[model samples]
Target: MTSQDERRAFWEERLAADWTETGVGYRALGRSFNEWMYRVRREVFLDRVGALDVDWTRARVLDVGSGTGFYVRAWQQLGAASITGSDLTEAAVARLRDHFPALRFERLDVAEPGDTFAGADFDAVSCMDVLFHITDDDRYTAAVESVARLVRPGGYFVFSENFLHRPAQRGVNQVNRPIGWITARLDRAGFDVVHRSPFLVLMNAQVDAGTLWRKAWGGVLRAATLTEPTGWLAGAALYPLERRLVRSRTESPTTEIMICRRR
Candidate 1:
């Protein structure tokens, strides 16, 4: 089978086995650290998206890669008129259906042709920590274009990525594509990136930095997080500092969120 097809199968089996919030996040960091990271994401999301002053109470929202329905809950808290959650795995869609029987959940593969809902149906689309996992170059490009098509003209697309400063960094299931290339892709897709800010500076993987000190620090944290108690303690200690960094820093060594509007 093709590598891209293998990626789809891998995600299907992976989430089918451990379909928890931590399972969709950095599982090696344990549940506490993942929970802390989600907390940080919540605050950052509210702060940034809320500042837009949009009438979310009347807006329809679509959340891509709705792992564990985290963003679905966020949109609901914003009082969106309606929200539909989509994921690349049946396991996620099935579990989300069970969790939120009132809401709609669908299986979607953004990079694949003929795998979308009615076009331009959403006022906003949230694809947090998801695009980087489309490790294939052609597929990544297609995903961006697909996202563009999914949003109405003048709608918003909010996503997060490492946005590496140097050349792209590739892993088994992720790629930290350069910020320049990503922006260019967005531009080609007819979207304007209005704002971007650090989502997590020190609490997550520092794939962009490629520094020895950063690697060593990451190693220490990963090792300490092997146990639940130590993981909670480590996350607690880092939570405050991480929040401060996310609030104060305009850029980050790890992940950052970008607010884009279709033009």
Candidate 2:
């Protein structure tokens, strides 16, 4: 099988096993922590998108990687005129269709050759916490370009990344790319990044940090994830603090959201 097929199967198996926020998010951290992490994502996402100049209630929106239909619901809450949710894995699409029969959910692989999705240009395209999963550099470029193509000129493309200043760090399924590499890719794809803000300060992966910080953060996560109750408590205790930090910080050691306009 091709690498794309392999990646699809990998996600299919994973979502089939645990189709929850935890399944799409930090699974090792368990359900409660993952839920909290997504709560943070929701807050940051809505705050950012709500502030955009577009009138969401009249805008057509597309959410790529609609894992567990989290962002799909966000769009719905914002009263989008039309919403389409797409995922690379069949498992997610099936589940999303079942859970949200009123919405459209399709199996879409953005990196695939030619057009992967069929629709009019969207006013906003959200591919949050999804790009890094395209491990191959060529595939990543295709995905970004495809996303750019899907958005109308002057429309928004909001995504999340580590935006590392140093060299990229690759894992089995993800890559934390440097800010320069990502910006150049976006520029070539006809996107002008207008806003960069913190999404998570201490609630998720710290792929760009030093060894000591990563280890220390790992220890804290281990403690928080000891049990479901502990996870809930930890999440509750740290959530407010995390929100403050995310709001106040200009940049983060972990993941951050970037809002771009098709130029």
Error of 2 at 124 (Å): 0.7
Clashing pairs in 1: none
lDDT of 1 at 128: 94
TM-score of 1: 0.96
lDDT of each: 0.88, 0.89
Instruction: Write down the worst ten-residue block by lDDT for model 1.
Output: 112-121
Q: What is candidate 2's local distance difference test score? A: 0.89
lDDT by residue (tens digit), candidate 2, 1-263: 13777888889999999999988998888899888888889999999988888888899899999989999988888889999999988899999999999988888988762555655689999998899988999889999998988999999999998899889988778888999999999999999989999999898867778889988998889887889999988888889999899899998989999999999
RMSD of 2: 1.5
Error of 2 at 114 (Å): 3.9
Mind giving the per-residue lDDT tens digits that candidate 1 earns over 14-58? 889887768788878988888888899999998898888589999
Top lDDT prediction, candidate number: 2
